[model samples]
Target: MTKCEISIKMMNSTTPSPSLGYLTAHQLENLVKEHHRSGWKSLHMEEAFHLFNKMLTAKPKPSIFTFNLLLIAISRMRNKQHYPTLLSFFNQMHQAGGINTDTHTYNILIDCCCRMNQVNMGFCVFSGMLKRGWSPNTVTFNTLIRGLCSKVDITDAIHLFEIMPKVGCTPNLITYNTLIKGLCDSQNTSLALEWHKKMVAQGIQLKPDLITYSTIIDGLCKEGATEKALELVQEMIDKRIAPNVFTYNTIINGFCRKGDIQSAFKLFEEMNEISITPDIVTFNTIINGCCKVGSFDKVSQTFKEMLARGLTPSVFTYSSMIDALCKGGAMDKAYEIFQQMVDTGIEPDSITYTSLIHGHSILGQWKKAFELFKEMVDRGLAPNTITYTAIMSSLCKEGKSSEVI
Candidate 1:
């Protein structure tokens, strides 16, 4: 049977099979307690289902807490594929009828629904929680808000944020952070800032954390307000919140996008001064920026520094360097870098291949360019418009204009 069919079957059948035998309520409780203490690190889905079945037959049945522990373990599993199974098991527990489901249990179900992208169902679960006379907590509101945000339903998310206080749930730092991030992600950075201002006004207890600063800084950067982002960085430091490598990378990328390589380099140096080790992303952004301005010397220097820091170069790292070398008319160096990338098990994407093709075409090496084009196609990479234009340009330069099509 398919997995879904099995889940349906499990949900409908609560009668304990005689062959599996039964455990006393104490034994089942101890088993769940042990797993809970371990943070469910080693609990497998099959073992969880087995425990649930055993619970069905245990004398006096396990308490709701024990059942919730098993459910929590399932939810915590790294593989999200089991989330549906968790919901199924919850249904089985509800249908069997004696255990009084608690607020925590409803929260878990609501979370599962939201994670599964069934935000409507999550709201239904919320309504059920209210009907059950269970008070929704901060986690409950946060999960629903995050779900709405994930769907880019910022209106509903904001509405929910406004109603939390009426429901006797005070919005916490996490709640504010989630809404801020949602607003920023939806390209409403201005409104996101308004919310940030509101968060700050809520008193010292609701002070913005590092995540809050970093997220808004990133949004500002994306909106081409690098200077404003820089000011916020200072504001954060003044508030005793140290910016991490990701924060620096975001601003550096913004400066690079604005074609202000000088400012990008300044941030790169500031990271060194602050003892925040530059990560691969930092080097890649610097290298790409340097490439754009034909600053090959800086590219070489930053790439060497990245390797010196024991960071393994990603495909993007190799691709940027290859493109830079190709554009600089250093075909020999570009070819060497391409080979090195392959030897390091980094596959060249269409951009990488297109760069090499264009480089060879510029050098009047039409034959070599065609060979790379064929290789790229054989590797299942589709030639984009730029790639086709490069080949046509090479053909036209070779006095083969008739073959341009």
Candidate 2:
């Protein structure tokens, strides 16, 4: 379909002026062209539908060719809400002397229905298409399977997938990816793996993308199978599939959670050596790992090293440092770093202030701690439960329970 046949315009309903008299198809074509050139493709479904209705109603006993334009117009809309509108529009067009529905028209409607989460309507369209002797294509089956997978009804998705070959419809990469993602989301890792294996066995020439590997790795990590996650990472490397930043971060985080700080550090170094530069998350994980083991000195040193490497420390980095310092009774130094944070153009967020408050309170500086609390409130920073707990405990230590309450 040409752009001229799919122009969309927004009508000004407030201006009730001269009625548009009878319009020929030629005039409608010209108007569509005029709108199309003026960036009509960017209009949303609502705006386009309103304009299209005006064009259709102007012509009495509009041709089925007019409905074809409407179909393409709705496809340009690319939104699910327009599916029913398209269906109703086509029905009305045929009732008003429109031509018979063709295979192309039904395919367009089915595709739109599937996209809009109305897979049942797509099925209805499919049945209609079949009754009219219109054969289903690969696009039709993929759309339905994808729609079912999107709703997480894996049973229906698998059933649709199985029937595709019966109808001579070959599943593509998108079909595999959609089903794989659904299985991964449902935590059916074994089935997801089986599907992946089947795809390979079929000589599908599959390229396991980052999402595919990450989903499996993350699932294994959550199931307390860190070894399996690591093994997958190694396998991805062996398969020449370079891991992305997220993949490295996931494994690093998993290692940290398992208290294997050494493994996490090794991965961090290996990531950089492989030209996968560490992001803020990578540094934060290692810093947090050191903090968990009460390795304050290592945490401080690592913070400096990260800064020296020109990595702008994020809020989490500073907060982790404050946490490690306070836990190690280095409140004075922690306060110094807190001041540097504000001076370095990185605005101290609530976490930054809370950590300093906790540090001062632990050092028996109740007045200083309270002043910081007031500053936090004045600066519009909300103190969380942890901040309140730290301050209250410090107050109780100074025999100021009544004042604290």
Candidate 3:
């Protein structure tokens, strides 16, 4: 498993030149490292196999270092496409020589298996590692924990975490973060908080990172614990840990959901005081809240201010605006905004078209409603069943049921 003291020029991407003669074992290992560092997707992947084949053909043979690099490179592949290739190469390494698998080798195999969602295979490898006296490291356990959490198997994830200390795998911050994220994702914010407290108690000197704080705050917000979420925000401030845009957005969105726009505005102004420019999510949350309250005046003000700050409205923004106008019976104004939405290259979705059509129908402008229906289809937007029903309802009210047929 020692690195051979041999160097070879690495290619960003090039075929192995035959005229260069058979590459030494070090050259093959170096090439694998280069392919890995440069991104496997960007390299001539077949060349890696070719080089490995050539490597196995050389005298003194490619050592475990060569295959280890190759395995690491294969692990970096984006998806399941190269999984077979990875396993094939791993098997080939053992057959090429009587070289025994090392801890790193087992670790790589277990990690790759878990990544491919082959957790059973990963566990099999884990068992073999244990039987072979290869003590599992924190990385080994962390990978398993992450894979389990990804599958939302929180019971097993927590179970595995509890056994870490017993197995000499001290749960690191990353391990705690994984558990916290899993709890939050499962919407068990109360449990997430308990874990957070436990993590803090164990590592007082290790301050909670921003991601940890944000996850807890977002979980609380989603649970409608706006007041408690605010308390956490204050705690972050007191600890001299600045709340980023996500933190502010979470709290602000929670307040908005509670229809506490005044408090939402207060935080909005505070973000500016701290020089934290609001992102699209921030503005969308506020705009959506205003739409819920039928506060067109406030919605317009926020929309204008967002534009003044050079923030372009996302699809959420435009839909909120059009819906608010339609609700208020401002069909003409809504139509104007709808045109502007497309003029600015923001295509209206079904909600946008439905709002405009409903507004026209409410205003008794049946001609305009039919025109919008035609335009919607012309734009290649598939009108959902509700949109079709809205138009039918309008025609029905106007005694045009025969025309509808």
Candidate 4:
């Protein structure tokens, strides 16, 4: 018995002078009908099928509406703990004159299965939908596409997209967006852009929504195609699709990553001119860019501006600042900021510790650097290869070749 069943049985036993009878077939049908007519919010599966024997032996079997209603209730079930109840409910519904396998119905099941990460079951349902001679619609294709995409099956998703037209379902914007995101996530930026162009050539007007623009720009940045990313931003603007916060952040971060702090600051000024209020991510990107170029004064100014603009600095902000201070040979200042980070409740992680140790090692402060290294290990932070190499290189520069090995 399911937990719900056990709970219902326990509740029944605790009632005074409990009505000790199971629901008759007639009562079951009537209760199901009542629940269906009045919105299925209150139908308990345990009560509906208490007398499983009589329900299965009913003279005129339950209708399809009865089973579908049960399925909807099953879908509303939020917890996996109700899976047994649901499986039993589906089994009984199938046995009770319910054609429990249709395209729409299977789509719902596939969605639930995908959300639960039961990919095999979802595929099984898809096969069942095909074998039943039910033509899968665009919505069905979209659901499966999304499911495959969620599992990072970009190749399968693209295959499904290509097959949609053959299946008499033309791809829509949602389908394109799904496939584009999948391709972008896999760093297949060129292919993703090719599809975007195809989308436009097929007379699908490109609006360059946040996700669409962000994906392409991010892909270009990862490939160091910052110039192309900037051009696309202009293309989006020329197409009259207003750039949102994500769009600006992507461009700013791209410039920052390329160490082009001047262009990043220029974009910041442009953002303000466009009446786009900067968010914390915007500040973090500019601050990070300044830090990369060793422009501590500019970093400080941006940090102050970020605070004055009522934006809260995130962990990235603190990380970048600590990294910048350390890079500028200001270990004392870096440690002071590290203490302030703890004062403000931001816990330091491996990257933060690595930055400080790397700075001291570079300056030949072997004792201080090793102390931080031991402290890092004691605090359960494992230094990565970069941290080890930094220390080894420092020791080698001081002719400590034996220790370097």
Candidate 5:
């Protein structure tokens, strides 16, 4: 009774794969979860849906396990910009009595709703789940807390956080991390620190993770408490909590913004000594600092070092180099790098083009400047107000405004 012709077309699905009919429902469910658990970009949501649909063609249609698997796949859908279809699927499953809606099912649904910023709908689901005598777990609380924090509803998030213990669900590390990050983002680092202390005092967080420390360090650094951030870094190191690229990048960026490039470089060197390979962000940060300090040689060396480590530089990297070269009055060198950037398939953005155009205009190279300006426009990049003013000023001074008309 299997219908090969019965195909469900998902218009918004990024990877529209065929319904996998080869595997059993259990195997299909396992594969779907494996894909979801692998990483953010690993799961193909459309294919998972298709597999679930494919399962319906057989006897003993997908159990709650398979139902939850489809839900999990939908929750981790990468193309969040697409219209939400998970709720529709949930409703279909619920109406058809295909499977029993358990605590896990509601948890997934609530998490998905919350992630979509539809926290009210998620709460409705929670109320329904509770009415059915299902006990909500820490994940249920964490999902809502995290969602509220995302919407800058720190007060509600805190209210929920405080009531977790009262509701028979203890606060986990994720609970604290979410609130701490929310407070830090609201620039209320003092209160975040208080919670951090409370988390430690509870003795539950005896072995805090990188996020726990990094969140506090990020807040301290933003508050111009770089010294305090450094102390936390040392504490993290002492506790053997290895700082990831993001953790180091945060502190390095803070130093660079504070105009303390020397300290940034020192931190960069420390990262190497600690066997933490620098990421693209790390190199980009240092490159930016080098540009500000007019250390062109160091900038070039860093670029080479980045390549030597098998890391491809970003569009920002090439753009920054071109800007630095232009600022140094080396227009020919800037043009060379710009060409190289294009050859590497890195199209220059408005800022990069403006840097080159302004440099050429300053040196009375009107033809070259105009060409760069035209190229920027032809590429569909609308010139900003500053870019237009700078280029117009150059052309008007050269009595070439008429030429534009």
Candidate 6:
């Protein structure tokens, strides 16, 4: 039989094929429902496909909802490599021609398409949904908008946002948040603010949520409008929205980038006051900020506090501390920290080695610097241009220019 003939036979088959194993449509649905309820973990792809084949050849075919459940499970697999497997299975179901596709089915397809970087295919699926007389819901619009945004097609995303109301679907908080993120990601924060204003003015009882505020704040911070971002944080609190750790981190990072370590510390204290524990990222940002300002004392204090709070120092934490000590002309202390980092099994990067080498070279300790360079190479870490320049410059300054070659 040809492919079409086999599909027709599969669609029309009443009795379950013995080769596919016997399972009633209702039993297969229960299996799928259980898998869905368990967070899509109980069913493997092969087992799901086996059940699907059994359902197809059963006396009564399963409902589209059941099929959608299986497809959702496949789509949501943690390993995204299963996305194409889902698309292929969807094609097989479509070719069989027994069950009609629904809006949820198309939405799943659209999401898979977008995730696969096939945004154009997602739009095609959207168009097909429309042609099938399926009214595109808010979820449909949100998914498409996100797809357009992921491709950096902000203009089209904005156009779609404008027409959402025309399709009898009002934009919700998710819709507003998605569009705002898109605008911000495209470096158009000014337009994002306008959308924020319009969302507030709509008076549809639709208020900007934490995500809405955070996205705009992050955009402003990226633009060096950190003071404005801080004002937004106040607005969030005034509106009875508690700023989470992520919100605080974004603002703190902004202050650090601006060299406003004092302001960053103030926010760090505020987080403690609000019962929001400062995470490792919070400590790292503060330590790095102190390093930049040459406030080695503050770095030491903060590093101790971070340990007191039971947070393990990351590689960045050690590197920043080591670099700061080296710059402070405290070679012994820097070496002590380096040894501590090694004892803790935190492998040093080229930055760490370069900092120590540069510090030793500054003191005209060329032998120690050379030993460090050799050790760095033995560790399979390549010395960068900064490393070479530090050694060569020190040799020239010591009137040992001949040894530089």
Q: Find the 10 residues in a row with the least total lDDT in model 3.
A: 1-10
Per-residue lDDT over 217-325 for candidate 5, one digit per residue giving the tens place of the 0 to 100 score: 8988888788788888898888788888888888988887787888998999999998888999999989987887778888888889999999888889888888877
Tens-digit lDDT track of model 6 for 175-294: 999999999999999999999998889774899989999999999999989999999999999989889999999999999889999999999999999999999999999999899888
Model 4, position 22, has a per-residue lDDT of: 54
- In Å, residue 46's CA in model 6 sits off its true spot by 2.8
| Per-model lDDT | 0.87, 0.74, 0.80, 0.73, 0.79, 0.85
lDDT, residue 233, model 5 = 87
Clashing pairs in 6: none
lDDT, candidate 2, 124-155, per-residue tens: 77886898788887777777777777778889
50-75, model 1: which lDDT tens digit per residue? 78888865668899899988887787
Q: Assess the local accuracy of residue 331 in candidate 6 as a C-alpha lDDT between 0 and 100.
A: 94
Best by TM-score: 1
Residue clash pairs of candidate 4: none
- Model 1 per-residue lDDT at 107: 91
- Score every model by TM-score: 0.89, 0.67, 0.83, 0.74, 0.81, 0.86
Task: Give lDDT tens digits, candidate 4, residues 34-101.
Answer: 77677767655454444333445555555445555556666676656554455555554455563444
Native-vs-model 6 lDDT? 0.85
Report the alpha-carbon TM-score of model 3 versus the true structure.
0.83
Off by over 4 Å in 4: 1-99, 113-121, 150-155, 204-210, 378-382, 388-405
Q: Which ten residues in a row have the lowest lDDT in candidate 1?
A: 1-10
Ranking by TM-score: 1, 6, 3, 5, 4, 2
Measured with C-alpha atoms, the lDDT of residue 58 in candidate 4 is 58
Of the two candidates 4 and 5, the one with more favorable lDDT, higher being better, is 5
**Which number leads on lDDT?**
1
Model 5 scores worst on lDDT over the 10 consecutive residues at 1-10
lDDT of 4: 0.73
